[model samples]
Target: MFLTPYVERLPYPSRTVQRAIGVAAVVTQAGIGVTGSVVRVTGSGLGCSTWPQCQPGSMVPVDHAQYQTVTQWIEFGNRLLTFVLFVAAVAAVLAAWRIVLDHPSRRRLVKLAWTLPGGIVLQAVVGGMTVLAKLEWWTVAIHFLVSTPLVWLAVLLLRAFNEGDEPPRPVVPPLARKLLVPLVVLMWLVLAAGTTVSGAGPHGGDPGTHRFQAPIETLAQIHGGLLVAYLVVLATFGLALMRGPVPAEVWRRYGAVWAVALAQGLLGSVQYALGVPEVLVALHVLGSALVIIATAALWCGSRDRGAPVSGTPAPRESGELTPAR
Candidate 1:
C-alpha cells in the first residue's frame, strides 16, 4: 500500500482496459479522412495557402482578403485533427507497453502501434509540402493513401489487444488459409485504384489544382473492375467457408464482409452516376473505411481461434463462456 504512489500501475485483466482508446484511433483516423474529403469537395484545399502557420506572419489564421473564414476553418480544423490522432496513438502505445512481457508474440503489434506517432509526423510534413505545391494531385493522394494503411495497422493493434495474452493458433487449416492473404492484397489494390480515381476526379483539393489526365469515366471503370475482382475473390472464399462445417461466427463475419463490400460498390456506382455530389463523396470516403474494417475483421478472425471464437459452437445457456477474442 505504501509503494502505491511510487509504482506505475497497469490496468487489471490487461485485455479489456481502455480498449475504447485503441478503437477511437480507428474512428478518428477515418474521421480525418472524411473531413479531408470535405475540404477537397468544398474547394477549400488551399484555404490556408500556407502551412505550419495558417498564413504569413501568423501561426494562427487571420482573416485575409484572399482566404475566407469558412474555408480557412475547414482546412485548419481538419489539420488540427492530427493532434487528436496523436493523443489516441499515445494512449495505444502506453497500453501496448504494459502487455509486452505478457504477450511477447505481440511485440510486432506494439511496434506497429508505436509507428502511429511517427506516421503522424510524416503526415504533417507531407501536408506542408502539399500546401507549398498548391495541393497537387499526387501529394494530396499520397497523403490520403498513407492514412489508409495506418488505419489497417491500428486494426491489427486492436485485434491483438483484444486477444490479450493468449498465444495465437490457427483458427482454420494451415493449407486452406493461404487464400486470405491474396484476397487482402486485392482489397488494398482496389483501394489504391479508388484513390487514383479520386485524384483524377473533379475534386483535386483546389479549383486550380492539376488533375490526373485520365477521363473520369475511364478512372471509374478501372476502379470498378478492380473492385469487382476483389469482390469475386472474397465471395469465392466465403463460399468455400460455407461449404465446410465452420463455426457460426465465421459465417456471420463472412455475411457482414459481403454486405459491406456490396454497400461500398453501390455507393461508388451512385456517386459516379450522380457526378460525385459532395455529400455522397464524403459518404463514399466513410464507406472506404467500412470496407477496410470488414476485411480486417474477416482476416483477423481467420488467423487464430486461440481459445474459441469465430468458428466455435455457441455455448449452451447452462454453461459459462468467456470470450475467445
Candidate 2:
C-alpha cells in the first residue's frame, strides 16, 4: 500500500515530502469547500440532476433541453473534484503510515490522517443526499458544516507533522491557557449561526428550493453579535499575550487569528449592508475556511511540540502551564 517500492526505502517519508502532502491535503480540502459555494451561487446544485449518476441511467451527462450545458458541466465538474480530494486524502494516510506505526508519539498523526479519508467518505454520502433532496437548505447546511471541522482537522494534521512527537506541552500561562478552547467553541457557534443565516437567505441552490422560516436579518444580527463577542475575546487575549511573557511565536499566531477574525467580521458587515451579494457570499465562504484554520493554527502554536526523547521546548523556561489535547 505504501509507495516506496519504486524509490528509496526510508524509515518514513522525508519531512519535506510529508510536508508537501500536508499542504496538498489542505488545499484540496479548501478547494472542495470553495467549489461547493460555486455550486450554490450558480444554482447548479443539481446540474447532474440525480444521485450516484449524472442522469437516471448514465454516469455521464445526457443532452436535455431543460438542463443547460454550462450548468451541467459546472455541477458534474464539482463532482469530479471529489475524486481529486479522495486521492489527496489517501496519499496523506500512506505518506505518514510508517512513522505512525513505529513511534509512540507519532501515532497521533495517523489518527488525524485517517480523518481525511473518512471525512471524504462522509462528505460523499452527504453530497448524495443534497442531490436526492434537491438541495434542501438543511442538507446543504450540513454539507457546508461538515467541511468546516475537516478544515480544522486538516490544519491540525499539518501542525502535527511539524510539531514533532513532544509530550503535549502548552506554552501559554494558565491565565491565558484557559481562553483557547472557548475560542474554538465560539468559532463553531459562529459557523452554525452563519449557516443558519445562509439557509434563510436568497441563495437556495435551486430557484424553487425551500428555505428556513427564520428571519435572515434576525439570524444575521445574532451571527454578527456572536462574531463581535468572539473578536472581543480574541482581542483581549491578544493584548494579554502582548503584555505578558508569552513566546514570540504565540504572539504572531494570535495576531493572525485577530487579523482573520477582523477581516471576516468586516466582510459580514459589507455583505449584509449590500444585501448579501452572491460574490460576497462566496467570499464569506472562503473567509470562513480561513477563520477556522487561523483559530486552529493559533492554538497549535501554543503547543510546545518537540521530539519526545529530547522534549526540550523553550516555553517551559517561562513556567507556563503545559496543556495537551
Candidate 3:
C-alpha cells in the first residue's frame, strides 16, 4: 500500500533541496518586481512597440536613436527577470513534488508551489497584452494584480519548507489573528488599487501615445485614499498588538512593518505632490515591495509555528518564526 507514495518521494533530496528552491523563488520574485518597476519608471512599457521583440522588423535594432532602442532594452530586461522567476518556480515545484508524495498533508503544498509558474505564465501573457493594448488600464491593472498572489504563494512555499515534519502551529490567538491577517490583506488591496491609478495616470513620457481622460488629480485622490486607509488599519493593528498579551517578537515585527508602511506612504505623498520625479517614484515602488515581503515574514512568524521557547517570554514561540517563510 505504501509503495506508490513512498516511491514518489524518492526522486529528490527532500527538505534540503526544497529549502534551496524556496529561497531562490523569493529572490527571483523580488527581482522581477524591481525590474518591472524600473521598466515602468523609464516609460519603457512600449519599448519594443511589439510583443516579444525589439521591433516589428528585427531582434537587435539597426537604429540606435529609435524610441524602441531604450524602451525595448528596459522592458526586455524585465521580461528576462520573469524568465528567471519562471525557472525558479519550476525548481520549487519539482522539489516539492519529489519531496512530499508520501506525506499526504504535504502533497497539497507541492501543488501550491506549482501553481506559481502558472500565475507567472499568465502574467507574461498579460504583460504582452498591456503593451499591445497600449497600456489600457485594465490590462495593466491585471498584470500588476497577478504578481501579488505570486508573491504570496512564494511565501507559502517557503513557509512549508520551514514546517518540516512538525504539526501545525498551535491555533493562533484570536485577537492576534484578527489583528495580523486583516492588516496583511489590506496591504495587498492597497497595492491593487494603486496599480489601477498607475495605469490610468499620465506616464511621465513614452512612445505609446496612450492617454487617459480621467483627470490625474482624481486618480491620485483614489490611490491616496487607499493609502490612508491602509495606514489607519496598520495603526489600529499596532495599538491592538501593544495591548494584547502577545509575544514581544510579535510586537516588534508589528512596529517594524508599521514603520516601513509609514515611510512608504510618505514617499508616495511626496511623489504625488512634487509631480513624481522618476527616481523617487522608483523608490516608492521598492518601498512597497519591501513592505509586502516584511509583513509576510511577520505574519508567518507569528501564526505558523508551535509553542513558545525559553527566556523569550511565556507568550513567545521560538521555533515558530522561520525567516521569510
Per-residue CA lDDT of model 2 for 1-325, tens digit only, reads 3443422233346677778888888888988888888888888887888978988898878888788778888889999999999998987887566554344457788789999999999999999998899989999999999988788899988887777765778777765677887878889999999989999988887887889998888999999988988987787676656555778888888878878889999999999899889899889998999898889888888778774321222224464433322
lDDT of 2 at 183: 78
Give stretches of model 2 more than 4 Å off: 1-12, 101-105, 308-325
Clashes of each: 1, 1, 1
Write the candidate numbers in order of decreasing lDDT: 2, 1, 3
The residue pairs found clashing in candidate 3 are: 308-317
How accurate locally, in lDDT, is each candidate? 0.76, 0.81, 0.69
Give a tens-digit lDDT track for model 1, residues 1-325. Answer: 2433222254422334536866887887778889999999999988888988888887766789988889888889988888998999987776665444334455665686788887888878988998999988888888888888778777777776666335655465543367788888888888888888888888887889999887878878888999999888877786667555666666777788899899999999999888889999999999988888877877777766353121122334665432222
- The prediction achieving the highest lDDT against the true structure is 2
Candidate 2 TM-score versus the reference: 0.89
List where candidate 1 sits over 4 angstroms from the true fold.
1-15, 101-106, 164-167, 173-176, 305-325
lDDT for model 3 comes to 0.69
